[model samples]
Every structure is written in structure tokens, then in C-alpha cells.
Target: MYQYTDFDRHFVRQRAAQYRDQLERHLRGELGTDEFRALRLQNGWYIQRHAPMLRVAVPYGELSARQLRQLAHIARTYDRQPDGPFAGQGGYGHFTTRQNLQYNWIPLVDSATVMELLADVDMHGIQTSGNCIRNITSDAFAGIAPDEIVDPRPYAEILRQWSTLHPEFAHLPRKFKIAISGALEDRAAIGWHDIGLQLKRDDAGHIGFQVFVGGGMGRTPIPGIEISPFVAWDHILVFIEAVVRVYNLAGRRDNLYKARIKILVKAEGQKFVDAVNEEYRRILADDPAGHEQLIPQAELDRVKASFVDPAGVKAEPAVTLDDGDPAFARWLARNVHGHRLSGYRAVTLSLKRVGIAPGDMSADVMDTAAALAERFSHGELRVSHRQNLVLPWVREADLAELFQAARAAGFATPNAGLLTDQIACPGGDFCALANARSLPLAAEIAERYQDVDELVDLGEIDLHISGCINSCGHHHSGHIGILGVDKDGAEWYQLTLGGSDGSTLSGTTTPGKVIGPSFAADEIADAIEAVLNTYQRDRLSGERFIDAVKRLGLDPFKTAANAVRVSTAKAPA
Candidate 1:
């Protein structure tokens, strides 16, 4: 994790103070709602369907245990839903696919205080929302992954500092996202981002990036195209600036639907690439500060130095645990992962248990997680893009003890990549943009698939859900995608098969195809079960769900799903 310098600490505190002043003025009626909207959005505050929602940025998903403790304090003390469906039920935080944490019930009047608290811990929501470069995400197993080409944290941190409040690209046509993957596998889902950077080395052993541009999800789901095969690591910032500059100048502003850079890139095609190249050439030749912007060796070294392994961790002899206990064996296989270091193992603290909404960690759970991090992970923790907390530095010898503690803490479900480990968003219940609720449906599916044996037999499945077309839950990337829709004021869901997140398991980055017409909300779970049953019956030996879907096509699964879709009148309560 990058340690904040004195300047970095001061910057967030000053920004928090500025936000407080702006919030006070807005509350006092001195600032109009429309004017204050932009001000508040820049600081990551949004008025949702029921109340104010605050999204706190977690850069590259790294967090200190102290920071996690403070977050728990904030949730316990200030987060409460006073009205709507969730009135009196709060004090929990929701982790997002973007690796940010959201609080849906925070009062607007108390938001300034929350900002100040965040600043105290060198954290803030600056540039987390609105039409700007959002928080840069990377593979969760960045530094410790065995297949890593380079440590991407330093570059991701450098990008984070560069894009935060950049004068030129603060506001673009639409919200922009960038993801980097240093691993051989695309764990960060880089192909689905506006700018996807894959860290690589040349034949001469020099670092560079393979850049992809224009991918996104929504009404139109398109994978990004390779804009540049390899850009020198030192020139990444300048090249990215050129790409954004082209989009800022030419991207559509007429319709919100067509305002994204993806749309612009799609429309312009090779012309867009040509324009970006021209812009890159001009920046280096014509712009006064362009050459100066190229990262110097000393700056790179300074950033990389902070990413070194913690002082206490050492390379010890490798060992494995094989207790007679089946539960322990299951947890060891599913929740634990191999580490680059000899002795260390990465363990996922499951947040997908039944009863609680997926990724919603209560105050107690957060505090316990912080304690677990301190005790086992060198006081550092990581928030995975899949909305789970990871102890990235747990010693191999500590697996049994950690498992026992984690089980007591309610996060040791041993279903890390299983069918029950679903990804969902706070849908219509909280988000104003949602057409239907996602939590209930996710809960229903989770409740049905509790047996670990059953889940393992089903294999690793990415079942993602979204309330609307916004794709916050990344439903388009799921092997089993469920998208909530509206039908004459009733809730319906559209099922899509064969989506993937571009991992070793999910081979490619592609959108799932809808099987047929949408099903009533009540019939969606049955429809999903029917599809899964079809896969179990017809799949070849050792075939995964995604492979079967691809090999057999969507016809049989479509028939199975349609067979289970009942009429609105026939839907069970």
C-alpha cells in the first residue's frame, strides 16, 4: 500500500474542509440545488431514491486496518435509515464492483462530518462520482499473484494521483473508468473498461502497457479495442491524456445515451485511433508541458518503494493444511488462494452469506474484519472487485486459526467462487435509477444454494444482477446474468447466458445474451434453476457452465428457462 505523504494528507483535509463549507452554504439556502448538485457530486454524495448515499473511494481496493476500524465507527454512529423501506435498519456498508464502499442511509446534514472523518484517515470521496475519471481499479492479487508481469500498484497509484482533480479532464462527456491488470489473466476485467491497461515487458525487459480503448456496459455492451499494442511505461500518462483529449473534444453531448466515449469510439472507428495518435504526436511536439509529464525514473522509484512487502512478513517454508474436518478442507480449497510469497496465502473473507445482502458488512462484521487483518494480514486488507474483503498476507500456518475465527465472524462460508457467491447491487430499494430490486432476488438464489457440495458440483459461476441498465452489478459480465426490468409497473427480470469477466475460468470478456422475453420477478429463481439443471444434464465430462453454454449454444438453456417462466397470475408469492 502507498503511504500518504504530508502533502497527500493535507490535500484531503483541505478538500474536506472545502466540502464542509459548500455543504453548509447549500443547507442554508445560499446555494441553489442545481448548483450544489455538481459540488456535492464531486465529493461523492448523491440523493438516492430514499435518502442521501455516500460512496467512499478505496483506491485499488487497499485499506489499512485502522481505516477499516474508522469505517466501522462511521457505519455504527452515523449510518441509519430514518424512513422508507429500510427505516431503522442501517449501520452497514455495501462494497461495490468498482471497489468502493457505499452508505445509502447517511443524512445530508451529517455528510460534512463524515467527510472530515474520512480526511482524518487520509481518505475521501474526491472524484469518486460524476463525469470524471472514476477510481482506477486493478487486479486484487496484483503484487502477490504468481503470474504477475509487474507490480501494477505503483502505476495505479501514479494514475490515481494524476487523474485526481486534473484541470483539463475533470468533466468529460460521461463518467470514465480505467482498469489495469498486471497478471497473465485478466482479473480486473480490463476489456470492459474505457481504458484497459495490461502491464507487460518487451524483449529488452522494459515495462510497457498494452492499451485498450472504448469498452463499456449499459444499453450497448461493447468490448474495448486494442488502441496500442505497447506504450512505454514512462509515457502512459501522456498517451492516456491524448486518448481522453480526443474524446473530450469529439464525444457526443447531445444525448445522455450516446455521451460515453465508447459511443464516440464506435462511431469514429479507425478515425478515432488516428485522431488519438495525432493528438499524442502533437502533445509531445507542440505542448509545452507534455514532455515534462513523462514519468521520470526517480518518481517511479519513489512510488514503487512504497509497495514493498511489509517489514514483518518473511519467506518461510511452504506447507499445506489437511485436517480431517471436511469443513476446514472445504474452506482451504475455496476461500484460500496461492500467494507469490512462500509462506503467505491470500484468504477471502466471504460476505455472501445468507440473510445479509451480498457484500453488506455490518458494523460488527467490519470491526471483526479489521481485527482479523491486524492479527493475520500485517494490518492490511484488500477489497476485491467481486465485493469481498481479502486478507492478502495471511501466513500459511495460520489458516486453521484464521478459518475458525472467520467462521465465528460469519464470513467463512467456503464459497468464494461457487454458485452461491453471487454479485448484486443495492437496486430499486435504494438507487433512484433502478427499475426493480436486486437484493430480494439475490437472497432467493443464495438461500436455495446453501450446500457446498452442490455448489462445487455446479462449478464456478459468475451470477451477477443489476436493478436496471446501469450495469452497476456488472450483470453483463456474469455467466448467468439477471437484469431487473420494468413491465407495466411490475418487476420482471431478463436472463442472459454465456457472459464472462475474462478470467482463467471465464475465458473471454463478453456480454451475455438474453434467452427470451423477461420473466416475472417471482419466477426468475426457478428459471435460473431450470437453466442450471439443463447444463448439468447435457454438459460434457468436466465441462464448466460457460463452456457448456458456448459449446451447446443458447437453445436448450433457453428452452429450459422458458419452461419455468410462469405468467404474472401464476407466479408464486
Candidate 2:
């Protein structure tokens, strides 16, 4: 596990103090509630339905056992320790869609204390949330993945250091999310980020990044434009700076809803990419040391050293996932992924347990997970881009028992990377930004596909839902995606198909129409069923629904949904 340096410690401590001062002044009637509310959000604080919520940034989804222990202490002391039916009656904590954690209830006064606690552990709330540089995510299996070209952890860490409270870039027009994945796997969902980078190696064995700029899902969704290619290791930061520069200068300022990098990329098109690249070339040409070729080998090496591989791990016999652990067997197949380490696999604890809101982990669960991290798996833990907690390096032998234990702790879900493993943002129920509560829509979908056998039979699918265009639910990347909006002062839902997160040139096909404002959860499922049935009849054996839908066109799905509505309406009325 990586330990914090003195420089890291000082930076967080100072940030905590600065926040403390700001909070005190706000409470003393110096700053208005509206002003303080915005400021507190920058530090990952949110006033949820029940109480104040504090989202703590777990950088790159990395957590040391000590850090986990400290998190447990915060849960136990400052908030209700929810383990039973009503323990966390009002609130506790929930890990989110991004790689972060949130304490659902904490006093404003306790905010400073929590900051001090995190700072003591060399953590900070700075840049984790709000309309600033958010948590930088990368391949959770960066080093461990067997097929990786190189470890992405070092590059991620370097970017983290450079972007944290950057002097000139702090206040952006909107939030920014940067993701990097090693050439091993698309674990970081590289296609659905503000800036997605993949570390690649050419025939010459020179390491560089394939940069994707402006891919995001919010009010509007678009695949990132490939503005540049084969960015040499030394020029990674410079290339990113160039991308940001283009966004800063050209991004929409008139409408808050239209201000994301994706929107900019969409409006600008290919000419924009070419223009930006030309501008970047000019900048580098004018001052090679000042721009593209300025990053030092020493700095890169210093970052590389911070990431030390897990020690004392040994390969052992594979656990019998099928024998006496059918529940775990399904889970292992869906959630566990191969690693670079010969004997290790990366496991995701499916927090999306049926009826409960996805990503909502209780405090007790967090503590238990922390304990489990220390005992069975490596002390390091990670959170996934898809709103799941990851035990990064579990040995093959411990798979079954780990799954059983995880089941007891509200995990053990086998629908990872499937339709039921849906992505939803905190909708109208909690978010001021949402038009409808996305969780209910997600729950409705989960209900429709509850049977594990049926879901498996359906095969691999990505179903993403967002309450609004902001796309917190990531509706843009789902093979079958749903978006909710308030039209004519009523909630209306839209469907889009053929969007994939792992493929080249991924984007939604023809957009679907606006459904009713009073659309029931069952209605969404009905529409999806119509789509699936069409695929079942049309598709060849073994073809995935996404592939089938792409082959036959989305009109079939549309016809099914429309037919269902007409039949149900005409017969009942």
C-alpha cells in the first residue's frame, strides 16, 4: 500500500484549516447559506434528504488498512452505526457511482473534526466533489491485470499531484473527471469520462497514451473525440493541458446544463480537434521546454516509486466456487475479473442488492469491509467506476469464502457487468439536479430481471439510467439506456440504444421518444421487454442483445414498446 509523503500531509492539513475558517465565518453570519453551501460542496459535503452528507475522496479507489480503520472510526463515532433494520434510520453513508465514499450524516461543526481525522491519515476532501477537478480514476487492476502493457498507477498518481488545487485551473466552468487505464483492460470505462487516457506501446516499444477528449454523460452524452494519438510518456501532462485549454476557451458558458466537455466537443466537431492539435503543436514548437516536452524523468520516477506491489501474496489452489457455494459461484463469474498476478483476481462486491438503492453501503458494512481487507485480501481496497467496491487482490483460493462473507455484508451479487448491475445517479429523491429519482427506475429494472438464471440467459448487457440530462446515471453508455426529464412540468423518460462503454466509436443510435410523466417502473421494464423479445426472435444464437440490436436496428425495440403501450391501454380502458 502507498503511504503519504510529508508534502501530501501538509497540503491536506492546510486545506482542512482553510475550510474550517470558511465554515466558521459562514456560520457566524459572515457568508450566506447559499454561498457556504457551494463552497462546502467543493470539499465533498452535501445536505441530503435526512442530514448532512460528507463524501470522502479515496484517490484512485486506493485505501490502506489504517485509512479504512480511520473511516470506521468516523462512522462509529460521528454517525449512526447502521447494522440493523433502523440503525441508520435517517442516514449513514453510501459509496457513489464514482470512486468515493460518503458519510450521510455529520454536523457542520464536525466537518472540521472529520477533516482533521482524514488529514491525520493524509487524506483530503479537496477536489473530490463539486465543480472542480473530481477524483481521478484509473485501472483498479492496473498492475495486477495479466494483459497490461504497463502499470497506470504511477501515471495516475502523477496526474493527481499536478491537478490537485492547480493554481490557474481550480475554478472551471463545470466539473471535470479524468480517467486513465493501462492497456490491459477497460476497467476504468475509458469511453465515459471528460478525459480518458489509455497507456499504449507502439512497435518501437515507446510508451505513450491514446487520449480521448470530451466523452461524458450528463445533460447530453457524447463519445470523447480522439484529438491526438500516441502521446509520449513525457508529454502526457502537456497533452492534457492542451485539451483543458480548448475546453476552457470554447466550452458553453450561456447554459449550465450545456457546459460539459462533451457538449464542447460535440459543438466543435473534428475541426475543433484538428485546431486544438495544431495549437498544441504551435505551443510546443515555440517553447519545447515550456510545453509538450517539459515533464522531467525524475518526477515520473518519483511517482513510479510510490506504487509498490502487494507484498507476501502467494498463489494457492482455486476455491471450489461451485461446490457448496452456488451463490458465490454466480458472483465470482460476474464480479471477479482476472489479474496480472498469476494467482490473484480482482473482486467487486455488488452493493446493488436488489431492492436497496445501488451503492448505498451502511457504516457497519464499511467497517466489516475494512476488516476483511486486512484479514483475507490485501490491505488495499478499491472502488469501481460503476458504483461498486473492489477487493483489488484476492487470491484464487479465498474466492468462495470471500463471496459468502460479502453476501452477509450486503454484497455477493452476481449481476456485475449485466443488466441488473445498473448504473443510476441519486435522482429527484436526493439530488437537486435530477428530474426523477433514478434509483426507483433502476429498482424497477432489477425487479423485471430478478432471476439470476434469466439474467444470465439474457447475457452481458449494460443498462444505465439518469434522472436528467446531467447523466449521473450514465444513460449514454448503456447498451440500453434510459434518461428522465421534466417535460411540461411532468416527468418523461427517453430511451437510447447501442451505446457501449468498451467499444470503438461508441454512441447511442437513434434516440427514442418521451414516455409519460407518470411512467411506472413496470412501464420501463415493459418497454425493455419489447426490445428484448424482438432481439430474441431476430438474433442468432449466442449474439448479445447489444450486437443484435445494432444489427437489426432500434426500430424493432421501439415497435415492441409502442405496441405494449397500445395493447395495455386499449384493453384496460
Candidate 3:
């Protein structure tokens, strides 16, 4: 994790102070509601269905244990529903797929205090919401992945600093997202981002990026086009700026649905590419500060130096554990992952337990996670894009002890990458944008697959659920995607088959095909079960769920899903 310097600390505090003044003005009615809306959104505040929701940025998914501890304190202290279904309860925080944390019940009046608390730990909500560059995300195993071509943290950090308060592209046509990947696999889901950067090396061993433009999911699901095969590391920032500038100038603003860069790219095709390239050419040739925009080797080195191994982390001899406990073996197989270093293993602490909303963490669990990071991972933690916590530097020698402690703390479910380890959003329960609920369905499915043997037999499946069309839950990229819909004022779910996030198992980044008409909320779980049954019945030996889906296509799954729909009609309340 990058340690915050005095400048970074001062910058965050200043932003927090400014937010306090703005919030005070808004509260006193000195600032109009319409005028305060943009200001609040810029500071990561939003008025949800019930109360204010604050999204705190976790830059590149990295967090020190101390920072996490402070987050737990905020959850315990400020995230409360004074008079609602959750009145007496507090201490809830959600981890989003974009690698940020959201507090749903935070009062708008107390938001400035929350901002100040975030600043105390070098964290804030800047650009987390609004039509600006959001958090810069990357692979959860960014620096530790064994198959990494280059460490992307330095480049991600550089992009973060460049885009943070960028005067030029802050107010684009829509919210812009950027993801980078340095590993052989596309764990970051970069192709689904507004700007996707895959760090690579040329034949001569010079680091550069394979830039993809205009990939996003919403009403339209499109994979990004490869705008450039390689943008040299020094010019990557300028190249991206050119792409954003082109979109900003040409992207639609009349219709909210068509305002995304993807729409612009899809509509213009080659013309979009031509315009971006022309802009890039002008930036390098015509602009006075073009040469100054090039990244210096010294600056790159300075950022890279901050990403070194956490202090006190040293290599230890690898040990083979032949534990007789099947549960322990299952946890090892599922949660533990390979690390670049010989003795270190990255372990995912499962957050998808039944009855609990996926990604929702209470203060107790947060504290336990912080303690686990300190004891096992050198006090460094990572928030995975899959909505789970990661101990990125855990020692292989401490596997058994850590697993035991984690299980005791409800973090060890041994279901990582399995059917029960689902990715879901806070749907109708909290989000005002959602048309239906996602948490109930996610919990029902998780409860149905509690049998560990059954979950393992089903194999690793990317089951994603979204409450609405926003794609915040990344439903379009799941092997099995469930999108909530409103049918005749009743909650319904649309099932999709054969989506891929471009992982080793999923092949490439592609949107899933819808499996006919939507099912009522009550029927969705059974419908999903039907699809899984079809896969189990027809799959070749050792074939993963995604592979079977690709081989058989969507017809079989569609038929199975539709077969489970109830014949009797239920009127909407």
C-alpha cells in the first residue's frame, strides 16, 4: 500500500474542510437543493431511497489495516437508520465491484463529519460519484500475481493523480471508469470499462499499454474496441486524455441512456478512432505543454518505489499441508491463491454467507478482517472486485492457523469461486435506482447451495446480480447473470446465459444472452437451479460451467429456465 505523504494528507483535509462548508450552506438553505446536488455528488454523497449514501474511494483497491479500522469506526458510529426498518441497528458497509465502500444509511447532515473521518485516514469520496472519472481499479492480485507482465500499481496511481481533479475531463457526458490489468488473465475486467489498459512489454522489453476504448454495460452492453495496440508508458496518460476528450466533444448529452462513451464509439465506429488519433497527434505536436505531459522516468520510479513489499515481509520455505480435515482442505483449495513470492499466498475472506446481504460487512466483521490482515498479511488488505476481502500477503506457513481464526470469525466459508460466493448489489432495499430487490434472491440462491460438496461440484461460476440496468453489480459479465426487472409493477428477474468476464475460464469479455421473458422474484431461484441442472446433466467431464455454456449455447439453458416458470399469474400489489 502507498503510504500517504504530507501533501496527500493536506490535500484530503482541505477537500474535507471545503465539503464541510458546502454541506453547512446546503443545510442552512443558503444553497438551493438543485445547486447542492452536483456539489454533493462531486463529494461522493447521494440521496438514496431512504437516506444519504456515501461512497468512499479505495484507490486501486488497496487499503492499510489502519485505514480499514477507521472505516469500521465510521460504520459503527455514523451509518445509522434512526427510524426505519434498520432503526436500532447500524455498522453496515458494502464493498462494491468498483473497489469502493458505500454507506447506505448515513444522514446527509452528518456527511461532513463522515468526510472528516475519511480524511483522517487519507480516504475520501472525491470523484466516486457524478459525471467524473471514478476510482481507478485494477486486478486484486496486481503486484503479487505470478503471471504479471508488469506491476500496474504505479501506472494506476499515476492515472489516479492525473484524473483526480482534472479540470478538462471532470464533467464528461457520463461517469467514466478506467481499469488496468498487468496480469496474463483479465481479472480486472478492463474490457468492460470506459478505458481499459492492459500493461505489456514490447519485443525490446519496453513497457506500454494495450488501450481499449468505449466498453461499458447498461442498456447497451459492448466490449471496448482496441484503439491502440500499444501506447508507450510515457504517453499513456496523454493518449487516454485524447480518447476522453474526443468522447466529451462528441458524446450525446440529450438522452441519458445514450450519453455513455460506448454509445459514441458504437455510433461513430472508425470515425471515433480517427478523431481520437487526430486529437492525440495535435496534443503531441501542437500543444505547448505536450512535452511536459510525458511521464518522466523519475516520477515513475518514485511511484514504483512506494509499491514495494510491506515492511517485515520476507521469504520463508514453502510447506505442504496434508491436513486430514476435509473442510480445511476445501478452504485451502478455494480461498488460497498463488503469489509471486514462494512462501506467500493470497487468501480471500468470503463475504457471501447466507442471510447476510452479499458484500455487506458489519463493524465486528470489519474489525476481525483488520486484525486478520495485521496478523497474517503484514497489515495490508485488498478489496477484490468480486466483493470480498483479500489478505494479499499472507504467509503459506500460517494457512491452517489463519483459516481456523477466519472460520471462527465467519470469514472462512470455503466457498471462494464457488456457486455460493456470489456477487450482488444492494438492490431495491437501499438503492433508489433499483426496480427490484437483489439481496433476497442472492440469499435464497446461497442458502440453496449451502452443501459444500454440491457447491464444489457445480464449480467456479460467476453468478452476478444487479438491481437495475446500471451494471453496478456487473451482471452483464457473469457466466450466469440475473438482472432485476419491474413487470406490471411487480419485481421480476431476467436471466441471462453465457456471459464472460474474459477470465481464463470465461474466454473473452462478452455480454450474456437473455433467456427469454423475465421470471417473478419468487421463481428466479428455481429458474437458476434449472439452468444449473441442465449444465450438470450435459457437461463433459471436468468441464466448467462457462465452458459447458459456450459449448451447448444458450438454447438448453433457456429451455430449462423457462420450464420452471409458474403457470399461475400473481397480480402486482
Among these predictions, the greatest lDDT belongs to 1
TM-score of 2: 0.89
Of the pair 1 and 3, which is ahead by lDDT?
Answer: 1
Better of 1 and 2 by lDDT: 1
Clashes of 2: 9
lDDT for 442 (candidate 2): 79
Output the better candidate (2/3) by lDDT.
3
**lDDT tens string, model 1, 36-100?**
99999999999999889999999999999999989988987899856433245448889999889
**How close to the true structure is residue 377 of candidate 2, measured as C-alpha lDDT?**
71
lDDT of 2: 0.75
Could you report the Cα RMSD, in angstroms, for every candidate shown? Answer: 2.1, 3.5, 1.8
lDDT of 1 at 413: 95
For residues 71-178, what per-residue lDDT tens digits would candidate 3 score against the true structure? 989988888856433345556789999999999887788899999999999999999998989999999999999999998999999999899999998889999999
Looking at model 2, residue 201 earns an lDDT score of 93
Local distance difference test, per candidate?
A: 0.91, 0.75, 0.90
